[model samples]
Target: MSSKSSSQFSTFKDCLARRLISTTDLDGPEGSDDPLDEFTSYLASEVWPALPDTLYTASYESLSSDTVLQEMASDPFYISLDAIPIPTSFFDTLTSYTHFEDAHDCIRFLRKVLSDYLTEATAPPPVWKQTRGEKCEICERGWVRLTYHHLIPRSVHGKVLKRKWHTESMLNSVAWLCRPCHSAVHHVASNEDLARYFYTVDLLLERDDIQAWKKYASKQK
Candidate 1:
């Protein structure tokens, strides 16, 4: 148990140190460079011990790691789930969660995070950047049609507004993309997660999956 625990914690810390990985994308407190560290530390110490020993029928003593997650899940705003240990449950696809839980889980989670969420390196641009209609920003392939997609998905607008940091216009932000790349984005993440995280082109491009898809799309007709 000790060896496994040490390995798990180290894997998490290494992922946190990545250049492409950002704390803001993880829904960490704003301006925090060490969000995961602080987040997990809180979970390990404070939250783990604070859960009620008994809830309805379940019994939780001293709030161990096992019990805290169950408590957190029940809380509407538990400050989000653990990103450390890299959650396979967060993903939705043809494959089962267990498919990603092997030795590959760590890198797979990093790839998932980079593709699915948005991070900030600077402030939002002064004006709305129009989604390109003449061509697709992601790929060189000529298309029969170009679609304008919400740079920040509209479905999550209601949730995003609750935060009060972004304007409605920002939520309605658009980006022109080819059919394949457009589909790619939606597949990579759910609408609400995208709105909560990615709202910019740079953040979109930084995704490893998007980068890979763009490379393939560029070569196609």
Candidate 2:
């Protein structure tokens, strides 16, 4: 029993850590950088153990009932479910609670805090400046048909595992394109190919050459 307890605690910590590091800003000024570390550390040491049985029950209930989550499900960029790790059982339990408003509040807190935790681990900051390209990255199609896409597909890199910070730097390259061009790009590219497409964007951005990007997209088209 003691061994099982220890293992569960360890799993929680790892989950907590992964959640934190994925979203927090590690590069900001002292206060601006991931602000939740202290709270999370405290929770690890004291709070999580002390949390009432009911809150846990309510939490699981709230997650299950959240209709808004489906919007995320619809995204083409979304990946596997484990990235965020909200168990189906927990969601079911969350939906069954009577104090649902309170449960909703708690769930929100956990989601926000955990997301922040994850950001701190995997990303640099909370927001990023958009860099615009005049042509589609997939087709040499010009700005009129261009829109930005995640070179690595944000859904794959961490959509299942959403980090506020990843949203900032991960989309470093924006291929300007119209809707049809964007659809065509995805239709033709394999998952692996899409991953490479982002890598190419990173390479071009590193060199600060838009013309090179245009040439690459032209070839892709």
Candidate 3:
């Protein structure tokens, strides 16, 4: 890349960081301005750290971070929504040093990083340090049959996919709760509201109604 191109890339990085800090929410990043740049920047800065290893943490898996940064820095990348021709030379170079085994591996890891990053940034923290197998995650009631409540709800899944509110895998994420606690959660918010804003258990637990439900239902039945 020429000096001018390098400068332009740096400017894009700065602009994106500022946009992220000031913007209260991200809706439909697929349609966001400069998404290609934002994605590239995320890989370079966030994914490349190679820290937060999944070996010891159930949290986000940081792939070989340095390799990702080095790959992009050596030769830039831009993904196009429309089909575009690429030089054979670009592939030859990208293939030579890529840490991934193949194109499939590359895509899988990249997608995982992007999706997990969004969830971690906005979703509320975990309510418990550890979960009990038979207990309702909310009211901590054992002996009652626990039902898995889709935190985002299945009814709004179509909206979630269309709006890009969350990655598809996250739709299956659930919170274990007794039937009473599960019913109370739905009363706290509409399915759409939960899908967009309170898709995480911690976020649901933040609500006044949910907090009160824990107390009221702990002794019920």
Candidate 4:
């Protein structure tokens, strides 16, 4: 990486570290320092090097053309049901635990319930819509055609797999965004960046360019 890019990355890493410390309660008996240390280490060892040049330079045609979308859809990286480890009998196990054996069993049951609740709570919201006239999720503009944007871009599924940060099920998630918002995303960030960081409508909307685009798109036909 160039010196400028490296410097920018360091600044970004520091900013992220501060934000994580302030905004998230990663503290435990092990202490808050460990989480901050681990996060900074992860950014240095894993995230910074994986960023792609295309994120800064990709054109709308490269990002939005039907050809590109079709290629991504046809890529063989899709996570099949067989690859997932959930046993077919897992739900049966849940059903069988009708009575608690002791305090430990009660704690286990409550833990499971809490785990399931958190999973359901943090899992990305569904973005697919059957109709075309609904307001755009990104800009909240009404009466516009919204397109389905793969949260983790299909084009970068291979990179995502290589990084081991996400699974096939996560890659298949999508968001409904307006044309300008969608275009601005690809314009500002590469497929790899999308897979790693900006993989949600909320994250994409945080970008300065996307925020500007949303303001502009909200005023258009």
Clashes of each: 1, 32, 0, 1
lDDT of 2 by residue, 80-193 (tens): 233444444343433332233444543553555444332233233233225555655444566355566655565566542253322234444344555655664466565444
In model 2, what lDDT does residue 68 have? 35
What is the C-alpha local distance difference test score of candidate 1?
0.51
Model 1 spans > 4 angstroms off: 1-131, 142-144
Whole-model Cα lDDT per candidate?
A: 0.51, 0.43, 0.56, 0.55
Error of 4 at 46 (Å): 34
What TM-score does model 4 achieve against the real structure?
0.44
TM-score per candidate: 0.40, 0.26, 0.44, 0.44
Off by over 4 Å in 3: 1-132
TM-score of 3: 0.44
| Ranking of all predicted structures according to lDDT, beginning with the best and ending with the worst | 3, 4, 1, 2
Flag regions of model 2 displaced more than 4 Å.
1-129, 159-168, 171-173, 196-198, 201-221
- Model 1: residue 186 alpha-carbon error in angstroms: 0.5
Whichever of 2 and 4 has more TM-score, that candidate is 4
**Cα lDDT of model 1 by residue, 50-85, tens digit:** 223231122122224345434433442332324334
Task: Put down candidate 3 lDDT per residue, 15-66, tens digits, no spaces.
Answer: 4444434432322245668654544465344322332222111222222344
